[model samples]
Target: MSFKTKEKEAVGVPISESWEIDFQDDFDTFNTENWQDQRIWVNNETHCYVPDNKYGTREVSDGTLKLKVINTGAQKPCDNFDKNGVQHPDTQYVAGRITTKNKHEFIKGKWTARLRLSSNGEPSMFPAWWLLGAENNESPVQEANENVCWPLTGSGEIDIFEHHGDHQKNHYTTGAIKSLGECDKGDWWSLRKGFDVSLNEYHEYSVEWENSDLVYRVDAKEVYRNVGQGDQYPEKMFAILNFAKITDAPMKGEWVMEVAWVKHEFRK
Candidate 1:
């Protein structure tokens, strides 16, 4: 689990000539100049293609997009946690989750998200910035391989910011490229210890994905970098922004995640 602390000299890869740089901008200055409103946003309605789960919503205030979810008086729904220990509850306890699904999708480029998140000291709460393949879905499959997806087949999945409430100072970040028929795969890495994450401050989580390599970073420091080669790597994917409370049953406390913005840029 190397943190990619070694600065290597610039290296290049060979790819199709059609691939070119798409977007390049500095959002640190704060301007709405080139930002495009996502095509899909959270609504009360349920759809077949989008996630209609209990705990996510999008709002607007002072020209900013605010996404939040908190547990209320609802009983926790079962079927939230899987065998791998991933929480997938049907009802939310005290958190919110959002994604740029129908609203936005990336084919291949450097994807960056600027966000602020917190466990808020509530147990079983996980906050993350992750991505999944749009083609990989749970609905009735049109074909066998047609429905197969990344984490499902161990294709290419990246978890940018994942925090457990039990540990407040550090978080876990992972990226893997599934191999050997989705069974054999790559590795994952956790961030350095003693990394203090303030509850209300903004930080940057980023992934630089190229032809056969992916790099994960936090606040400009590279934590994990995997140089992979194969078709399991994702050529395109979408982003998810969420802070969720995990409960075996619906119990309550305090947990929240605030996102400032998300940006993606590429240079060849």
Candidate 2:
């Protein structure tokens, strides 16, 4: 629970000189104006996202935002049914998810967050910080015809940080989902890296997007870069922060992902 102050720097470019802050949240308080609590459940995930603060789905305190996954001990039929009309049991576990859809959408820029995850590593916990095209047809937070189904168009998806607790400690994954032909057939181009980082420690995760190049970084150090050329993501994208449970493995009482702050900066 110790907080460490680290300098924020961008590789090859000085943050202060090359970038201008566009959006930021320090979690001093939950700003509903900037974020919307997402309640839909997909991805065959084990938890149902709820807006209830009592369930620890979302809470702000001590200058940090905590998105928690809680076990409710009882199962309730899910609102979203599967392809076969079978409803999944969802209430056995409830988690939190929030997005900036339609609130703060931006095109090419730098998106970053400072986070510390619960160290329990239940193998079922999945925490992620990502961005989706504002025009993505999935939720349609914007216009209808403006919808572009996933990786086929727009900014696609940029996963700045993803931690699958099932993996070895200190391992994380980052990547982009791009269209191959159609939205259903997209490529999940990604990279995995391991560090000495512990889940209990705070670390900065970021992605810098310039034209067609993307640079991923951890604490200002470069980890991976994507130089592929196909379609340049020219549309605005919104941010999503969530902690999902993807397994049926018996989980501890509760799991949490604490985020100290999030920021978006555009080139000046």
- Best by lDDT, which number? 2
| lDDT tens digits by residue: candidate 1, 1-268 | 2222122222332333222445433334323343322212111211111133233334434434444445455545433333234444344343434554444557656677666654444555556677666554432223354354435442355666666655564445456434334522334443222234564567787777656667777787887766663234544666666654443433354444656667766554
For residues 58-166, what per-residue lDDT tens digits would candidate 2 score against the true structure? 9999999999888889986556443345556746888888998878988778899999887645688789999887877664345765567667667377788887888
Off by over 4 Å in 2: 1-17, 80-88, 140-142, 189-196, 229-231
TM-score of candidate 2 on Cα atoms, chains taken together: 0.86
lDDT of each: 0.49, 0.77
* True-structure Cα RMSD, model 1: 9.1
For all predicted structures, in order, the TM-scores are 0.61, 0.86
